[model samples]
Target: EPEVTQTPSHQVTQMGQEVILRCVPISNHLYFYWYRQILGQKVEFLVSFYNNEISEKSEIFDDQFSVERPDGSNFTLKIRSTKLEDSAMYFCASSEGQGSHQPQHFGDGTRLSIL
Candidate 1:
């Protein structure tokens, strides 16, 4: 079965620095999304991309955050300025279609540590 894959399983960066989390979803998936889980906190949705544009985004996806599919297969999340509170496990997911009915497959995630 196909699955989502993320690179650089772990990343360490200083506060105020920039970081990019990368992922590659199942080849046939059409919707891609980014989510993060802070230690002891619930998983929060960041943004979803479809048809080469942003389909939906949560408030957490402020100006400081952005997502892109630069090579048609890879989806990336760029955080312009990292903060201590930004430390979390960022997960990349993809689904064949939209809505709650469609199952979203997740990657192992990139654990980001902001110092």
Candidate 2:
């Protein structure tokens, strides 16, 4: 089955370092999203992208964070300056349609570690 794919299943970064997490969403899905789950917390939305633009982003997705689709096939999340609190499992998800009605396909996730 077609599914989202994320690179470097495990990432380790020093505090104040930058990291780029990559993902290739399901073949034909139109809506793409990024979410992260801290060690003991629920998954939280980071940002959503559609039609080459960011549709929405949460406060946690501040200046230090960014999202992009450079080649029309891969979606990326960049953290310019990572902190201890940024350590988490970052997930990539895609859906054919929008909102709650659409079922999103998620990748296994990239585990980010900050030290």
Residue-level lDDT of model 2, residues 1-115, one tens digit each, is: 8879999899999999999999999988999999999999999999999999999999999999999999979999999999999999999999996667899889999999999
* TM-scores of the models, in the order given: 0.96, 0.96
Lowest-sum lDDT 10-residue window in model 1: 96-105
Query: What is the alpha-carbon lDDT of model 2 when measured against the actual structure?
Result: 0.95
Candidate lDDT (C-alpha), each: 0.95, 0.95
Query: Candidate 1 lDDT, tens digit per residue, 1-115?
Result: 8889998899999999999999999999999999999999999999999999999999999999999999979999999999999999999999996676898899999999999
Task: Indicate the residue-level lDDT of 4 in model 1.
Answer: 99
Best by TM-score: 1
lDDT of 1: 0.95
Residue 103 lDDT in candidate 2: 90
Error of 2 at 56 (Å): 1.0
